[model samples]
Target: MPDPQSLDECVSIQQWLQREHLPLASPRPPAAVHVSLYCVGKSARIPEGVIAAARQAGTAIEACQFELVFDHIITFLLPQDNAIVLAGNGGRELWQLHVQIAIEMHRLGADANLNPNFQPHTTLLYDKDVVPRIALRRPVVLAAREFVLLHNRRGQADYEELGRWPLHARG
Candidate 1:
C-alpha cells in the first residue's frame, strides 16, 4: 500500500478481489455513453407548475452554468424504468433528504419511482469482453445544482433529459 499507483500494486489488489470471490459486474458497452436527467418520482401525472419550474430552471442553468461533460455510465435499480424523473448529487444530507422526499411523495400517492439505495456515479467505460478492471477514484465535487426530467423510453430505450431544475438550496 506504500506506493499504490504502481502497476504491480494494482495487479496485487485485483488478485485479492479474485481470491475473495467477490462478484464483479460485466462492463458496459461503449455505445451506451450518454447524458441524462434521471427520472424522479411519478406523480400520477406531472404537475403543470413543477414542469414549468423545471423548464425555467433548465433555461437558467443553460444560460449561466457551465455545461459539464462526463465520460461515465451509471444505473440505479428501480422497480419501473421511468418512475423517477430527476437526479442530482444531494451531498450526504441533501441526498438523504431527496430519498425522504421520494418516500413521502410515494406515501402521498405521488407515483414516484424511488431508488432503494441511491449512490450517484458517472461511468467511464463499458467492457464488452471483461468487466472493468479498475476501482473508482472518488471524483472532485462538480457543479450540479439540479436534476432534470428525461423522456422515458422503454427499459432498453435511449432516454434524453428534457429539462432541469435547481436543487432546493440547503438552508
Candidate 2:
C-alpha cells in the first residue's frame, strides 16, 4: 500500500463506487487498495527456502521506495472470477521486483498458480455479472517506502501484513 494520503484518496474512490451501487467486495476501505506483487497461497506450503530467497532478494534491492501512477480501471469478467482494478504505469522497477519474488517462489517449489502475465494493479472491487461503469480519473501517485508480504486472514480480500521489507536500501 501507499502513504496515508494516497490511501485516503483510494478510500474516497471506493466510497464513490459504493454509493453509485457498484458491487463492492467489502465494506471497509482499508482493505480495498493495494499493490500485490505475488499471491503465494497457503503459508504452510510456502517452503522456508522460498522465504529465505525472498528475503535475500529484498535485501539486494536498494530501490525500495515506490511511486506508482494510476489513472484507469480494468474489469475482468471471467467466468470463474470477476474484478475491477486500477492499473499502474508499467514501472520497470516494480516489474523487476515481481520477477525477483516469483523467482524465489519458483525456486522454493511454491510455484503453483504463479501468474506469468502479472500486471501490477490495486483492485477496487470484485463483482459478478454487472459491468461497472467508471471513467478514467486523473492519475493518482501512490508512494511507499516498504512493500508488505500480506497474508489472507480469512480468505481473499481480508488481509494482515505478515512481513515488511523496506525499499531504497543503500547497501
Candidate 3:
C-alpha cells in the first residue's frame, strides 16, 4: 500500500478524470488504493490457517523500501467494465520483493500464484467506456514503505487489513 500522501495524489487524479467528464464508475476510497501483490483466494474459501501462513510469509520477506513511479493512466478492458489505472514499471527492487514474498509463501505451504508477467498498477476507477492511455504531466511517485495483506469481499468497497509488514530502509 502507498503512504497517505500518495493515496491523496491518486484521489486527486481520480477527481481530475471526473472533471474531464470521463465515464468513471465508483470512486475508491483513499484507504483502498493499493498495488496488489498476490491473491490467495476468495474470502469464504480462505481459511484462517492460510491467513496465518500469509502473515508468516510476509514476516519472512527481507527487502528494502522502494518507490513506484506511475507515469501514465490507462484503461484495461474487462468483461464487466474497463478498469482505469495508474500504470508503472515498479522497477527491479519491487519485482524482487514480489518474488521473495511468493517464494516465502510457497515455502510455508501457501498458494501464491506468482505471475511471470505482472504489471504494477493502481486501479483508480472502473467504467464501461474505454479511454486511450494518457501520460501524466508529472509522474506520481509512491514510496512503498510497507505492504499489507488484505481480505476484500467481492462487490464491496471496504478492505479488511489482515496484516502489515514494513520494508526496512536500505543500508
Candidate 4:
C-alpha cells in the first residue's frame, strides 16, 4: 500500500474523475487506495487460521523498501463496471516480494491463489464510461516501505487492517 501522502495524490485523481461528471461506482476514501498483493478468499467469516497464515507470510519475507511508479491511466472493462486505474511496473523487487509472500503463504497451508502473471495497479474509481489509456505527464511514484493484511468488508467499503510489517533496508 502507498503511504498517506501518495494515497492523497491518488484520491486527487479520483476527485478529478468526479469533477468530469463520471459516474463513480462507489465513494472510496484515500485510505482505500492500495495495490492488492494477494487475495485470501472471500467468505462471510474469515477463519483465524487464515489471518494467522497471512501474518506469518508477512513476517517471513525479507525485502527492502521499493518504489512503485504508476505511469499511465487506463480503464478495465469488468462484468459490473469499468475500472479506472493507475497502472505501473512494480519491477523485479516488487515481483520478488510478491513471490516470497506467496511461497510463505503456501508453506503455511494458506490458499492465496497466487497469480503467476501479476500486473500491479491501484484502482481510482469505477464508471460505466470507458477512459482510453493515457500516459501521464508525470508518473506518480509511491514508496512501498510496508505491507498490510486487510480484511475488506464487501459492499461496506471498509477495510480492517489486521497486521502490518515494515520492509527493512537491505544490507
Per-prediction CA RMSD (Å)? 10.9, 3.5, 1.6, 1.8
Off by over 4 Å in 3: 42-44
**Model 2 lDDT per residue over 1-171, tens place:** 768887787777766666675654543447546877777665645566655655555555555566788777677665755666767675877777777776665655556345768777787766664444455557778875687776555555577565777887534
Clashing residue pairs in candidate 3, if any? none
Candidate 1, residues 1-171, lDDT tens digits: the string is 012232233233334433443234332222332233234434445566555544443444321222232222233444433111112343454345345445544555554445656544433222222333333353223344455556544444344556545555444
Model 3: which ten-residue window has the lowest total lDDT? 18-27
Best by TM-score: 3
Best candidate per lDDT, number?
3
| TM-scores, each model vs. reference | 0.39, 0.75, 0.92, 0.90
Name the lDDT value of residue 48 in candidate 3: 85
Query: Each model's C-alpha lDDT?
Result: 0.38, 0.66, 0.85, 0.82
Model 2, position 78: C-alpha lDDT score:
58
- Clashes (N, CA, C under 3 Å) per candidate: 14, 4, 0, 0
